[model samples]
Target: MLRALYTFLIVAVLSGIAIWLADNPGELVMHWRGYEIRTSFVVGVGAMALAAFLVLLAYRIVVSFIETPASVSAYLEKRRQQKGFLALSRGMVAVAAGDAQDAKRYAAQAHKLLDAPPLTLLLAAQAAQLEGDEAGATKHFEKMLAAPETEFLGLRGLFIQARRAGDRDAALAYARRAFGLRPQTPWAAQAVFEIEAAEEDWDGALKTLDRVVSAKLIPRDDARRRRAVLLTARAMTAAEAARGQTGEARKPALDEASKLALDAVSLEPRFVPAVALAAALCAETGRIRKGMKLIEDAWSAVPHPDLADVWLDMIEDESGYARAERAKALAARNPENVESHILVARGAIGARDWQAAREALAPHAGPSASELPTQRVCELMAEIEEGEYGDRGAARGWLTRALHAPQDPHWTGNGYRSARWSPINPVTGEFDALEWTAPSGVLAQEEVPAVAGKAEESVAPAEKEEAPEAAVDTVRALEEAGNASEVLAFQPPLPDDPGPDDEGEDDKGEDRREGERKW
Candidate 1:
């Protein structure tokens, strides 16, 4: 509003001045090259204004003529950029939708028009992968690797391809290169760790594990546990290498092994493998007192068969009774432990004390004497019956019970029970995955047998009608269980029946006696 008011006032004043000049009747004169020209003041002003307008018009015409080609070029460039961006968008959509042909088509257009190497290569590689063209994918990945920004992605793609083709060496090479390029990359770090572990490169694996832990790729506790396992393995290997050495040659290796073993035990006191290794190393180095103390501590924490085995190995040459006494002492440390009870039972068996063995395992055997027996408990009972009472039937019954008993604990890993501990799983190459746990509840359940001669028992007539359905289910379960074992009926021989080898055995005996008499 102020600007408009100012403009109105200036225009009114300029008009008044022009009017005054016209009233005064003044003249405008010009002379150029002896050519004199005269006009009224208003005419002169009008002429000047017309000349200025003409000059401006000519200037605009010249500028338009000069910029025509550049303007057209700029418009074309803008159109090209639009097309490139559109192609890029289409290529991304095609990749998402799994349209290999469309993706490849749009990727080529984006490559040409967009002039972006990373996006072009990524799209082309994805399209090739969608079409199962590994060579084409690899070609694009190689191109990506040439650029520093996309090198990590390219390395990862190539690494995956190598692993798919079962080329471990190539995979490892790619993983190492990628890790060197970007140590903080999670995939690169994990790949290096897994490959090093699979190859049994303990030192390299430890370094990779440390890197992974520092990167926070895995939890702190998991890293510590794995480190403990790796250290234990290292110590055990070093100890073995030092076995035949003497003097200074063996001193360093044994000392390092013992230190690593102790560190492992301290990290995880219940880790039976490391405990056993530590005890064995202590005993081998004439540290008998130290070894015994280590075993006792481990037993008190978690009674284990491996610990018992290592303890027994410390004095393997002792008599059965002495061995039994030593195991009893160990078992006393953890009386409530199931494994401790099992160890006590084993010791009693070694000492030929059947009652003691039975008493040791009595609590876990369910309410009945042999009900719900564990595998080891059943085996022990079988041995006891056979050795003490000489009852073949009872022994056979106990052996059958063992087949249906809960599985015994061992060095279990990846659904398998190994006889010994190793740094890696034999099947899956998993590190420190094994634990002293039972194999029960993993596979098919064990089948059970019904009591013999149960058909002679009669049901109560009063309750029969009310419990018919339940009784039927019970009978069905028994029948199914019996069928699982599939006991073969022992048919008696008929009067005319004779085995195929009966005559041969009789003829051989008669001829052998006659030949011996003749000789």
Candidate 2:
């Protein structure tokens, strides 16, 4: 409505102007190109209006001519940028697809046109790395670092390269710089952890881990697990350092580890490494009862092989025979596990239980088995038969059976192989072979009676057994035996006479052990 009203007003004004011009018939004059002419007012006005329209049209034509080149240039530049971006996108896709050749080609093209766009440079570096072109990768990464906008990317690239090259010092430098720039970044924290761990800088690693946890870069659960692993490693290092030192020198480190282990166990009940390390440290510091309690608690939660080993180590002097018997009982709890069987067999051999050892090896023998278990069983059986059992015929038969058993790829006519098994000794912090030797002709006798009656009697009848009754009985027995109080009482004792140098070493070891326990 407003637009119509404005249009009406404008039309009325124009008509009034035209009427006045016509009615007045004023005189007007015009000059053009060295000539003079005179005309009535209306005629002059009409000529002027016509000339004004022509001038306006001429101005429009000139403006169009001026803008044409700029418009064309802008259109072409836009297309170039689009193509460059497309190449970059394709390069990233190629990298994701693991197509190294295509990724490199597209990355090169993108870089040529885009010239160190951070994302483009990152892609190019990754592509170069994939193609094993370390120099090229480094150059691209350096380019990224040269620009302030791409500094973080450059740092990350350098970190990756350093790690790939096994240069812990360089990696740590890059990682620390990146962490300083972006403390909350998960990659930065992870890189720092790796670098510090590689350098055996346990103190630095623990600090980085704490930062990672505080920032929530890693989940609390994951952080604790990692911390515990680191702590265990650190504890092992400290233990090795104090191996031949006086007890006073080693006490602090062991005590620290014990505390860390206790914390770790509280955080994650099933953390075997922390439990084992803590127990070992406790025993080392003469807190044997405490260490035993930790081991027993962990064992109840999960029957870990490490726990058994730690328990054996602690009780070796107390009663090797009793320890072996305890291991056998533990093995009975998890009959289907290969490791459990192996441990039980080993324990039985240690306890001089020849018959029991032979029985344990029966199920794991023959041509359908591996060499490691078979060889271990055979060796133990041979020793028993030749020395104590006095059954050479039985030993030969068992050995023959083991020799004919199916070969396991994991065993090279040697001991068992498991990725989960750490070859490094916790006490020594060094790689050591756990060798097993089998004498010739040491196999289980085919005529031996099966211990089926004992097995059946040991396990409660499925139909008649009351689970709650057994559980109650167990609880009552534990309560009566003061096991709970015993466990609670096993805290590490702070030494009253910690020497000057011992104090620092103690804190360092404790901190390291705590880190591992957190892990």
Candidate 3:
């Protein structure tokens, strides 16, 4: 509304001025080339207005003429730029799709049509990498590095290339540079870890791991586990370096290892490798009792072969009667354990107690139908028959039963076979009573048969059988026959076909295995 009002007022003013000019015409004089002429006011005003209109028309014509070619050129250039960008986008898509040939074609076309943009160079580099053209990839990456806009990507590419080429120094250099450029980069930290580990630079690896943890690149627990492993490895390396040196020199390494192992165990209590190492170091430093206690505690919480071995080492280091007594004590602690039983039996055999050795394996014997326990029984029977007990007939019977038994069974056989304890000795064609104890756990009481004349004659009046009563009688009979120790050996029977809960226990074992580092 206001604009219309302003326009009306301006038009009225112009009309008034026109009327005034028309009504009050003054005489006007013009001079040209020294000649004078006179004309009326209305005619001169008309002439001036006509001249102004003509000048405006001429200005419009000149501007249109000047702009036509420039506008057309700009339109063509914009179209060319759009086409180049479209090809570049397609090339990027092709790279993502792993179509190296198509990516290369589009990339080259885009490069030719447009000025060499960093994105185009990156696409070409990726295409070259996919095609296994390492040299071409490297060249493009280097070109990208020359431009500040693409330096980070170029550095990453160079690092990857160095890694693929097995150039550790270059790879490390690039990775460290990348990390310096961006400390929170996951790839850079990971690359640094790989490089440091490869170089046996555990300290550096550990520092990198800390960065990874701080950045939350890896989970905290995972970082702890990895750091523990690296620390353990470094400890081992340090120990190895002191190998030829004097005891004083070796002590520090061993002490360091023990400290590392303890730290690891503290971080992850069930870390068996650390437990074993710490125990071993403790034993080496004349702290065998402490080591034994640590190992025992760990074993009680979670069983590991290494812990058992460490315990055995401690036992073996004892001398003469002390060693024998230690073996028996360990055996008594884990009466059903095949390993402990074997160790005790070996000690007994060394002491020349043939009958005791034979008796020690009694709990391992079972009904002939089962392969594993029967095999262990047969092995013991054979040794007794051939060596000390001189019961060849019994040995032969047990051996025949063992050989006839199925090689595989639903239970027990897995552990038995893993120990590789055959019922009959391969070389002697006899049973190895000594081998019966090699299995890891205590012998099951059901394995041992009832001894003759253990109970008085029974009066039998035919009556309905009671299943629960029968089971009680069987257990009582086994106990009366001195097989109660075996019956009570393990925690309990594990359910068949265990589920996720059961499988998670296996992961604990796996974690320990992962922590172990071989010297």
Candidate 4:
């Protein structure tokens, strides 16, 4: 409305001036270049205005003509940029799709068309990776490192490549650089931590883990667990170093190890390995009561056989009955857990109390139980039968049942299973990954009978055909036993017992095996 009003006012003023010029018409004359000109005042005014308009139009035309080439160049540059970006986008898509050929083609086209080497370099590296061209990818990643815009990206790429190629030193270097550049980046921090851990650089890994915790890259609980694992590992390393020392020389090292282990337990009280380690260190440092308390606390949170073993070791008594009494006390801490019952049974068997062992195990392993007993439970029953009745036949019968019993829980993590605990997973280089859990495929041949029949089916056909008459007689005898259910009531541990393999081992040997637990 304002613009239209302004336009109307200008037109009205011009009309008023024209009217005034017409009304006050007078002769006007001008001479220029020896030429004379004469017109009415209104006509001269109109002629001057027309001449000014022509001059402005001619100037505009000349300016446009002068700028034509530069304008066209800018337009072409913009079009090229758009096309380059399009190729870059397509290349990224092809990379995601795993179309190596298309990715490579688009990457090359984008590099040729785009002036942005930083942007195109990433596409080129990804394309090369898709094509399985490690050298090509490495070259592009190297080029990226020279550009400030792509430095972190280049570091990440190089770190991955180094790991894939099994170059730990190179990977560590790249990961450290990346971590320094961006401590908040989860992948960078994680890479650095994993590499440091894999290299057995526990101190370095612990520092890296602190950075991870500060950045809040992982959940707080997870960070605590990982930190605990690192501390435990450092404790183990210190313990190992102290083993060669004697008397006063060993005291300082053991003290440090004990402090570290205690710190780990403080972070994760329920962590079985940490608890056990802390307890063992306490015992070594002549703080047996403190170690026992740690085990009891951890057992209540999560009943683990390791805690039981460590608790037994802390006992001053060597008699079976005393051990059984202490074991019963530990079981009372986590009475509802199946491991608690197992612990009691194990103790009773050690005390030669077969009836106590049977009663402890019968709830879980008896015929009326909700589920079949685990291999460890069945084995315990065998021990009870052999120790109590001098009945080898009944013992063997229980052992036979054990062969088909469900597998007991062990230290399993990251596809690694062991009868002992470790702070790190050797397979994945992950911290505190091990947990006392049933191994995968815990139940074997579920469709088969839960007895010798299942074992017979598992044997080779020729072995089954050539089965000795004595073995056959044993199976028949077990079948004819007064009550098969009664035979299944008590379970015992096998030779390869999963209950904390560190028990009875020397401290030096246990420390050596800390990072070398068999998968």
The C-alpha lDDT values of all candidates are 0.75, 0.65, 0.63, 0.78
- Which of the predicted structures, 1 or 4, would earn the higher lDDT when compared with the native? 4
Winning model by lDDT: 4
* Per-residue accuracy of model 3 over 1-519 as CA lDDT, tens digit each: 999999999999999998998788888899999999789888887899999999999999999899989989999988988999999999999989999999999999899878866778888899999888999999988887777778888999998898789788999999998887888898898888866776767788888888888888888878877776676566556555655468677877677767776776677676666677778878876788878777766665655445656666775445545655655765665566655555565555556665566566655553322225544345445555445533333344444454333222111232222222222223322211112223344444442223211221131323212322333343334323432232222322111211112222356654553354111
Weakest lDDT window of 10 consecutive positions for candidate 2: 490-499
Per-residue alpha-carbon lDDT of candidate 4 for residues 1-519, written as tens digits (9 for 90 to 100): 999999999999999988887788998799999999999887788899999999999999999999999999999999999999999999999999999999999999999999988879989999999999999999999998897788999998998899999899999999899889899998889888887887789999888888898898999988887888888888888988987799888988998999999999899888777788889888988998999899888888888877877877775657999989999999998888888899999889889987788888877877567889877787788777667754454456666666557767766776676666666777777766677777556422433344545565566754543343335244445433412322122222222211111123467754564443221
Error of 4 at 359 (Å): 2.2
Per-model TM-score, in order, reads 0.73, 0.58, 0.58, 0.79
Q: Rank the candidates by lDDT, best first.
A: 4, 1, 2, 3
TM-score of predicted structure 3: 0.58
| Candidate 4 lowest-lDDT run of ten | 493-502
Cα deviation of 510 in candidate 2 (Å)? 59
Score candidate 2 by lDDT.
0.65
lDDT by residue (tens digit), candidate 1, 286-382: 7877888989998988777878878877875678788778888998998878778788878888889877777887876635454477756776776
- Give the count of colliding residue pairs in each prediction: 0, 25, 8, 7
**TM-score of model 4 (CA atoms):** 0.79
- Any runs in candidate 2 off by more than 4 Å, and if so which? 1-48, 55-133, 316-380, 400-519
Best by TM-score: 4
Estimate, for each residue in 1-519, the C-alpha lDDT of model 2 and write its tens digit.
Answer: 999999999999999998987789878766899888888988877898999999999999999899989989988888888888899999999999999999999988887777548878888898998888999999888887777889998999998898789787888899899999999898888878765665567788789988988888878877776676666666666666666577576677667656766775776666766677778878878888888788777666566657777777775465657877777666766666665666777777777775566567666653445544543455455555544434344344444443443332220122223313232322322222222222233234333223422333456445223432332243234324432332121112112211111222346654554453211
Any runs in candidate 1 off by more than 4 Å, and if so which?
1-71, 213-220, 236-256, 366-371, 410-419, 439-519
**Each model's RMSD to truth, in Å?**
12.9, 19.2, 16.8, 11.0
Q: Looking at candidate 3, what is the lDDT of residue 434?
A: 19
